[model samples]
Target: MRSIRLTRMDWRDPAFAAGLTLFLVIGTPLVPRGQGIEIQLDPLGYTLLIVSGLTLAFRRVAPTAVLAVTSLATIVYYYFAYPGFFQPSAALVSLYTVAALGARWTALVSGAALCAGLLLISFRPAGLPDRQAFDGPLWVGGWFAAVIVAAETARQRKAYLNEVEQRAVDALRTKEEAAKLRATEERLRIARELHDSLTHAISLVNAQINVAAHLFDRDPDRSRTALFAVKDASKQAMGELRSALEVLRHDDEPERPHSLRQLPDLVKASEQQGVAVKVTVSGDSPAVSQHVDLAAYRIVQESLTNAARHSRASTVSVDVRYDYDKVTVRIEDDGEADSSSVVREGVGIRGMRERVAALGGEFEVGPRPTRGFAVKAVLPLGRSEDDNGGTA
Candidate 1:
């Protein structure tokens, strides 16, 4: 189909000119050439033919002007009994030129004028014939039909091409929009991962550094412990970052999951900084979705980090309660009476809330009844059988 279209376009201009020339040459032999009832071919008739040919050459460049000049010459030739073929041939080229150049009204009016000229030129005033001679109306009507059909075909073809071009443009725009949407989603996922990993690690390091700074002179051994805690936090941060990068580089690799099973290491790391965290696992840990487990782990991490940063709390409690169909986590600090004063809504709290919300869960963060702030989260564990199977 594409090759055919290319061929048609390649030959369109020359084809139109060639067709018009053939029509004129074929009519030449049919011209009546005798003495009595014959059409006379005089100098005036030759002049009209030359002018019509010149006008045909300019048909595509200036269709209306060519049609007008040819029509006027035909009318003058009628005064000297010239042949009727010249006007109809010129009008056919004029109709095609107007259609190709996006001038539909010009094509229509020129077709009408050609039909009128053919009618006048073919009329014989002498007598009616036994057999009908091809007279005015037949010639006029035939040329009108041919010209109008060609012009309408050209117009429809142009409209179809325009529609195809518009569809291609729309498809390109939709593809670009989808690509932009995917890019935005990927960025958001990366941001959430960074918040969960880097922020927790940084908070732990900051707590250890503050402890080491305080104990540098009085207790060098305890200060050494604080330094070790900072080292562990930094290593864990690098490990998580590397894991994240690995997934980015190789999408097919299975992601390693973070869960509450790692909570002991988290507390010991904080205890090294002189912050005592009391951990309790009340009910059997239910089987949970990977999304729910990750959210639970992040909530505890952010809560403990917040307590270490903002409270003079000597005792922090990390509690996990697992039910048949749900898991609940609660972190509370029993520190200075003014611990709640330092707690404010920050990115960590916002991210924890967002994570819990993503899993059809609920999160609450505010001051506890006794003292200090508490962070609590509850997540569904799917069916009871799944939750029981998840027990470890």
Candidate 2:
């Protein structure tokens, strides 16, 4: 029972209570008397008027109950005398309550009741003049119109607030989704870079170690040289792995630029694994943008690494063509099947594809009809300068 009362109290508004109080106080003297030409407040009549005024204090907390009590009091007082200001004042408040509580149908029914009560009071055995007679239909219609307009206004305001809140929630959700997507993409890219750089170096180390093991009994000097190559390859792989991991862990860390200048080092690094690489540049190459240059270098690096690991080819070609509008890099190996017959694409190829797509370039990797696997990349060098500061 207490909980039910608390729930009803929660629905009441302080503003409605205040309005009811003010109306009742100002209209208290309007209580009528018999032969209503003169003002007369008998003790009993004044006490009932005061009770009606006090009812306004709980108007919002119990609007329907307050309205019924006030209406009944007004009918009894006027039935013994004539119409008064308190009756109309209570009716007006009840109409406003109907609008405030969003009870349009209740307001309509109450208005009809008020009209019928007024008509019965004004016209009994004989009808009064136009000034004294009640305009039941007109008063009912006007009260209902005012209540509906007020209720509709309240509904529209509530709807507008709800819409604003929904939009804010949607915007926050969208930002969260975008951030998650970016983090996932970054993780995938870092994984690919690590695989491409470390796998090739580790393969070289393995090959050198095998040679040293076989030659240890025949030629000690050659075996020592092979062991030295294995140590060097292991160190190189560790360095590349650390660098790639550092970039992934700390976004603010500065990265050294890798470009065409690093091609010689890359070629020598692959040679340690016994895979010969030849690089050639053709055409009066257009000046490469930083992004395109970096992309071109990585493509060559990943492709050579794949060839060394998957294709048992002795010779691999790195060809770069710089034209007026675009720069293209091609890495191809001669026909030689490696130990593994099933060709598998590691994260390296996926990273390469993402890189090229981000730069609005094209990447292709597959076996040539005549021979071994090949990787081809074509990037628009002219637009690279414009995309320099842009994000993918």
Candidate 3:
């Protein structure tokens, strides 16, 4: 099947029609024959001139067709030896429209053909004399060249403006895409923080709640203590959750970053779940940036949480070593570990790795040779305080 397309034009624009009407009215008059020349307007020449103007009126609708029709009429006008010194203005108008609106090759070919026909007419034996033979063609060709040059300049200017508009549209689209990506990343970071903060404390609470329920009837006093421990863990989890959510608050709201000083409290909280943890701090512990502080806290939190939840171990040891330009954190559990399963990581381990990696650091987690699981991270301190870290 063939497809048909419809187009609309503003016929209300009277510029072309009005100009054509004025040109026909003014140029159709004849000069009385005199001074070795006989100039008279015949019926055929007047009709041809009217036809050329009518064709020029529709030039914008089909410029190539209009140019061809007007050029043919012009050739006929000169062929019959019409007595007029002025070439048809309609032909020049049609040529200009074609050169400005039509394809480059079509405009060039039409202009050349029209000019060549005019040159032929200029050399007609009974027409312009020998001395003035080259005058008509030179004047007409130069004027045609000027019109073509102006049309080409307009086309180029139009193309440049279109290109600039396209580039602006592309830049806007790119900026929106970048904003969406940043929002997505912020959501992921919030999710990881929520998990890291709540997971370990919830696990501790679950363990304590189970103990309290088991001893509720038989040992009332022990059950009361277990319930109190549950209350403490839940309260701590709530505090950390509120701190993490502060990121979504207004700019004036103060943000709480989990600092290295909180490591002792984290270890004490893990001990409340019946697992013993020994923490050691070595080297001079200097003040760190906010991102590094938060990342380090999350790393230790996930490590101890994993020990409480997965590793059936009695005790875990944490070693923190701070140097002039780096901080290293290592957590090891004296738990029986499956070498095969240890090689495979879960979300907690991945989150720790992502945090360290965002700071251009090194992270490792696996089963130790003897019979335990271990996680170690070496974080560089060369970046500025303004720099931030990422989550899994």
Candidate 4:
């Protein structure tokens, strides 16, 4: 692709040189000149003019070389007193090309050499006036100076256009990076929600299944209650699944976001799983932002699920404290752990830790010094909407 682009550029320069050469060849004879004695057009004069015009095709690639060749040829043609004079169009173009290409010193030095060489011509071409000498050189130098200023202007404008294009590219790259990061964070959030909801709901369903199978013959009423509990757990799991999948719907409809306000329902679900739960709240939950609220509730749910599934604790205690600057959560169980066995962190425990840490909270989970297991977290508040996907 790059070579093709360069080839195209090469084609354009030759076309431009052809136009200027054709103009120099035809326009010289047609344009009227003042009354001055002149020698007829000869083969050598044509050679000089043609040589200068040909050099212009390489102006962009070798501006200084083209400038030197054309400037020398134009001075030689006029100094020998050709029939009519022609403009140094090729030389002028080469000088402009150098400046426009941002080679400032090369343009200036090459232009100075061109003007100086032309000035030395005394216009002694078959008895020409000395005053014509001054006028011709002055006009050429003036035109060269004007070309330099114009080239500088064009170069500055091109530079500005390049800068604007670069800025646009940078902004687009930054936006793409931000979108990728957001997608990764969103995937993590969805995973945590799924783990918490499914683990807790499935634990209740499994426990009820065991109860219903065991009591079907001995206690029909209790067995029916366990079956009803299984149905409710499945229904609640469906609702939670829908809620977690709401983002894919891309709607303005409200969401059933989890919060500490729903702890009673969470506790009842765990109790149904055969683990007694006691929840204590120290501060009002209304002041907590929804992100923090969702995180806190998921932490509690994960804690309860781990207790019922791993610890097999008969009783669990949950404490939530909302203070001036932060909220604290502590869950402990009474089930005794084996002294020789090592406790491993499952997906539920890791998900709980991630949830708290994402909210800038600190989390810890391990066997207690005296008894069973404990999970505690401290989540600071006052995060802005922009920080948490426009949720306060």
Model-by-model lDDT, in order?
0.70, 0.71, 0.77, 0.79
- State in Å the error of residue 288, model 2: 3.2
TM-score leader: 4
How do all models score by TM-score? 0.65, 0.69, 0.82, 0.87
Task: Give the winner by lDDT: 2 or 4.
Answer: 4
lDDT of the structure predicted as candidate 3: 0.77
Candidate 3 wrong stretches, greater than 4 Å: 1-27, 30-47, 50-66, 83-90, 101-109, 251-254, 342-344, 382-392
Clash tally, candidates in order: 2, 0, 0, 0
Write one digit per residue (lDDT tens) for candidate 3, span 228-263. 989999998999788766877743435655777898
The residue pairs in collision within model 3 are: none
lDDT (0-100) at residue 369 of candidate 2?
67
Best by lDDT: 4
Ranking by TM-score: 4, 3, 2, 1
Q: What is the lDDT of residue 206 in candidate 3?
A: 97
Residue-level lDDT of model 2, residues 152-239, one tens digit each, is: 5875687789899999999999999999998897777677667766776777888888889988999999889889988888897888
- Model 4 lDDT tens row, 229-275: 99999998998888777866764434546788899999999898888
Candidate 4 at residue 59, lDDT?
A: 77
Task: Give the distance in Å from residue 91's predicted Cα in candidate 1 to where it truly belongs.
Answer: 2.4
